[model samples]
Target chain A: MKKKHIYIYSPSSAVRDKAAYRRGIQRLQALGHEVEVDEAALSTYQRFAGDDRTRVAALSRAAASRADVALISRGGYGLTRILDAIPCKAIAKAIERGTEFVGLSDFTALQCALFAKTGAVSWSGPALGEDFGAEDGPDEIMEACFDDLLQGQGEGTGWRVPPREAEMLAGFRGLHGATLWGGNLCVLTSLLGTPYFPAVDKGVLFLEDVNEHPYRIERMLDQLRHAGVLARQKAVLLGHFTGTRKLPHDRGFDMRTVADRLRGLIKAPVLTGLPFGHVPTKVLLPVGAKVEVAADGRDVFMVWGHRHAPGHRAH
Target chain B: MKKKHIYIYSPSSAVRDKAAYRRGIQRLQALGHEVEVDEAALSTYQRFAGDDRTRVAALSRAAASRADVALISRGGYGLTRILDAIPCKAIAKAIERGTEFVGLSDFTALQCALFAKTGAVSWSGPALGEDFGAEDGPDEIMEACFDDLLQGQGEGTGWRVPPREAEMLAGFRGLHGATLWGGNLCVLTSLLGTPYFPAVDKGVLFLEDVNEHPYRIERMLDQLRHAGVLARQKAVLLGHFTGTRKLPHDRGFDMRTVADRLRGLIKAPVLTGLPFGHVPTKVLLPVGAKVEVAADGRDVFMVWGHRHAPGHRAH
Candidate 1:
């Protein structure tokens, strides 16, 4: 395993679980990686990691760090409101110089905005605390994927669709050179009308959310469809939509119902069962990369080629 | 009160409470309004009042009924998905002929789309079951507002801002002839980037929601702000945002903080305490009407003038 430089910062909520954060940093250090934490990583203002100005400055510091990876401490309720103040160009410059900007949930706002403004790529992957600092330690698969990223060995990712969905996958001709974009559904949908929302037509859009009811999920998808977004996509990928509360009034409606309904509405094939979202056993996905996706039986493969090489610089 | 014809239909979710539906009808009859229920009002398909086609036809029937008003049976998780299939032009035509189409929550989608497509006005008000059919009887203020709509005497509506917010309301110079719009914040935000979203400039945007946390509410408002929607508005009126769950992790963040932050962000005044939303005390406000708004101490008044007159409709 290659030892790498990792810069950890908080651009979202305040760290409510300090123990988890500490464990995460310790875990990364144990893996022989040099981890640097931002000065304002633990700062709090209201429910945010810091005030808008503070968070913006923290981002600037991360971009300037020039580390192997710039990872979020955690994602919560921030970023969306301070989008205009974000330093997208500097972050894009950092990415161009090989800094792998990475995070999920609220981080989707920054990723989508940077892509929209500067066509910069970021990673929709684990947060330090939640994924790495879990009481039982990080999932082995997640760690392996992270290691692949650190070693510059990640070329693609694959997962199997449910048995009942295999037939639908068999009919999919797959897509080539499509932009792989999207992270948290709620965050992405929140950017729909904003300039921050990326325009990636013929792209493969993957989405996941937590705690949102099936109706709200369907509503967000409908918003995408109504905005002519779904029609322009080559395919729509579904990650794990976890923590959805099932109500008796929902009758038979669930994520499956939402997916099935989406399939019926758009020309794009709606593929489900992606290994990602607010779950621990998640895969790292390139947010702004052009990728090829193909399916054989129920197994789906997405390839983006080698993005970085080992011993990628910086002091 | 002048007896008026009322056309009741279900264009969104299915009526889960049959007893409430019966009571609502009976209540309307007792009020001397001749209530004519659409044949498919009680029909159910999954969680919807009916399937998309069925609901669309129901909307058509309501439009063609030529009744004094068209009221929804209830509101639930529907409408946003069926925007494209809705009979907007027909409903707009009905509005021109003085059939005041009215509903809220999920109905915000139809109201917004109609205004966007044809500059037609609808009502951001109560549904039959939830408002008129309460077990303890209807709220007097709500019933009075409905009577005013029926008698074509509704000139405007007013409410007193919370004392903590009174000074801020006092500073408001108010708006003149600004387009009055917005309803059900989530539904309104859902239409943000779509063609169905109204392009109302210098509009008095009134927003409300139920079951959304303060963070979520602020996020939606942020989306509106980021999309340049809030900057385009003359003033922002916040109606009742109820049913928000209290989370200990919120750390003092709530609707009050959300409103305060909004007031600081936008040049327009963020006025709260509008008598509307999922609550029983809601007042009917014309969705797309040109109106004047003025603040007097704690009391804020909005005037849309007389939209309809009594004893002049079809049988």
Candidate 2:
């Protein structure tokens, strides 16, 4: 694959680990990709990467750079502050020029805003310091999957979970051409009732989060279900949910119990074991792309682009 | 005040402190109010006061009982799960028959749902175990405020904050007849984009929470602001926000900073020092009531029902 120009910028929280960020940039360069760092990428203003104006300006500049990809430096808690001021048109124009913007966690605000405002797709996988800058380097699966996505060679991706759970996904066997949407659950729920909320119809919605307890997760899923967002979806995919600490009040309920309750409440099939979210070995997924999803025994496949025609059926 | 029958029930979390709950009921009985406890109020069902069906049955029975006041036994995390099964019409009919449903915290979901579905007014105040059953007994201020509201004598309630913050509320001096709405901030945000969200125009929206850090609080406030709820409000009243642990990453930006930032973003005056929420010394507030509010120097007053004209202004 040809070397791609990767533009790195910070649109969320302040980066406290300058050395790790530097190491991430070096790793990208070593991988034969040209890197361009935004002026405010390393600047700190309070708890943010920069003040609202600086973050907005940095995002606008990165959007107009037209690089092969715009990768976020890190995720924290800042993007929602400057979401209204983001230059959505410029980002859409950048997408038109083949620039793929990518990040997860707090970046979900930006990606959802872009999709809501312009119907443009963004990547929901990996980050600079969080993924690529790992002490032992990026996880092999993440690195290979990201590279394949960037080179436009990954027509489809598949993952296998424990065979015991195969029956849970059997209901989604022939689903096809469902628009895959959603990111961090908390971020997505934050945008509800706002203009920045995406109104995807009959889509395959995927969600994952970190550090949130099972009750909190159930509350968010309840919110989406109450909002009629889940009822309109063709399928609901569950990814990784890590870093949750069990509270004494939780009784016997956990993430699995939350997932089971959600499956019982919503019309769409809820299937687990998606290789995505705040984990090291995450899959790179297109946020607003139309994709075909099918579950066969313990294996699930999600394919986009030329791999399958729109609404293609699987026997 | 004449003797009024008060029906106590649990529509959310199970009663972990059985003695405390019993003590609360005894206290109400000692106050000369006829107290009737629901059959399932003490029954436990895995973190809930009872199963979903049991909770819904209790709520429906409470509403149909036509008791003068339907007070929730406690607040935890069950109401949201049974919102659809709630008999809003029966609850509204009970209200018409002089029943006043009351509770806070998780009860916000039930209150908001009732208001949205039937325009029914509920109480945003104390609960059994948390307030009346306190080790030292019910707080004097809470008992007094609740008595005033229950006897129809609380046409107006007044409270004082630090004189230094009086100027912050000065903008609301001329505002009158603003529909007083809102409960727990998280619960209110959870109902966003749902049919159960009350559309109160030009209202006085109040919010309070417990255990949420400033950033989370700010995000929810931002969601409301972005959804156009704040801009349309006559004033935004803030109650207690306590029990949040300061993390090393806060960098000195706390709840005060969040309130300050919010004050600058929306057009409505953001006033603090409301005697409500999870705190012990709180005033009983009439949810969905149209009230006249004004800031008089260091003192703030809220008056409802026959005490003021629709657009009464403060001199």
- In candidate 2 the C-alpha lDDT for residue B260 amounts to 82
For A1-315, candidate 1 gives per-residue lDDT tens digits of 878999999999999999999999999999999999999999998888989899999999999998989999999979998899999999988987888988999999999999999998899999999999998999998888888888788899999988988888888888889999999999999999999999889999999999898889999999999888989999889999999999887778888888888989999888888899999999999999999999999999999988654444443
Q: Which pairs of residues have clashing backbones in candidate 1?
A: B14-B49
lDDT to native, each model: 0.91, 0.85
Q: Which candidate number has the best TM-score?
A: 1
Residue B92 of model 1 has an lDDT of 88
**Candidate 2: segments with Cα more than 4 A from true spot:** A162-164, A306-315, B306-315
**Highest DockQ, which number?**
1
Model 1, clash count? 1
Writing each residue's lDDT as its tens digit, candidate 2 over B1-315 gives: 667788999999889988888899889999999999999988777678888999999999998777877899899888888878888999987877677788999999988899989888888989988899998889999988788766756676777766657777565555677798898999889989988889999898989999998899999999998999898998888999988778876777788888888978988888788988889999888788889876677788888863223333121
Q: After superposing candidate 1, which stretches have Cα over 4 Å from the reference?
A: A309-315, B309-315
Counting clashing residue pairs in each candidate, in order, gives 1, 1
Per-model TM-score, in order, reads 0.98, 0.95
Quote model 2's TM-score. Answer: 0.95
CAPRI level of candidate 2: medium
